[model samples]
Target: MNIDEDTSAWLGCPTPLEMYKHQCAMLEDELTTAYQLLKKARANIAGLVQMNDLLATEKAAAESQLRSVSADLSRVHVQGSEMSKQIMSLKIIASQNEHLHIENQRLLLELSVLRGPRS
Candidate 1:
């Protein structure tokens, strides 16, 4: 081949092979990093799944406790209602007793007046 000036100049030009090798090495590191990241992500997802199951169990327990509380409240309300009725009945009985007492006192006074010495 004849050593043309243009050919010599082009042959002396620097190719980017070194840069490409560096980039390939960087890409390999990045791929390993990504794989590690994926592994961590999978572990986190598994933990999240376990946490979700635990939360579901806790929710069921809380629901059961709420039902028990509601039943207790209902029972207490019924007992309160019965107590209120009993109080009203007692008040009525007390009023009747007061009226009877007043009548008995008035009768006693009338009897005493009639028994006054006949002058």
Candidate 2:
């Protein structure tokens, strides 16, 4: 139909051109908001990535420390075992010394008896 006829038919409604412009403005605002949100999301993602990298580095450091501690513990265990073995040897020697002391004391008593009563 004619433009005037279409305009007349719209009767109190906004004209098509005005409606289109308003819709375009609304769409532009929505696009701007979406772009801002996207930018914020990218920033958040970058921060998370950096945090993850830091955590990974910390984990590696902790693991290295754990390995070092494990090595130290292993050395301590070996030293403790050696100490235990030395203690056992010492105990055996002490027992032998006690027996030798008792035998020597008995021999001295026998020698005194063999000499008869003192003058």
Candidate 3:
């Protein structure tokens, strides 16, 4: 409780100079520990920064890919629409061909009868 320069200086056992040396050594040890902890903390911070940057970059890439996929889907839809139109046109043509075929068959039968029966 009474910390006078004379009473607490030498700690009542060691010389003043030895006490000073001991105090200096203890302070040096504490400073070294603090410095090491600061260095480790700094390294951790740097690693976290790098990780954050990588995540941001990956997010951007994913967004770009999503845009590209959306565009491709639009193109596919257009192509499908065109194919449907072509199929419809072909179906109409097939119907016309079928009608012509039936008419031709009727005409051929009539011609055979007009020419008379074969021996």
* Best candidate, TM-score: 1
TM-score, every prediction: 0.74, 0.66, 0.55
**TM-score for predicted model 2 compared with the true structure:** 0.66
TM-score of 3: 0.55
Best candidate, lDDT? 2
Between candidates 1 and 3, the one scoring higher on TM-score is: 1
- Lowest summed-lDDT stretch of 10 residues in model 2? 1-10
Evaluate all candidate structures by whole-model CA lDDT and list the values in order.
0.93, 0.95, 0.94
Model 3: CA > 4 A from native: 1-42
The digit string of per-residue lDDT tens for model 1 on 9-90 reads 3667545786688889999999999999999999999999999999999999999999999999999999999999999999
lDDT by residue (4-114, candidate 2, tens digit) is 455544568877898999999999999999999999999999999999999999999999999999999999999999999999999999999999999999999999999
Q: What ranges in model 2 sit over 4 Å off?
A: 1-12, 99-119
Write the residue-wise lDDT of candidate 3 on 1-119 in tens digits.
Answer: 76555665355688878989999999999999999999999999999999999999999999999999999999999999999999999999999999999999999999999999998
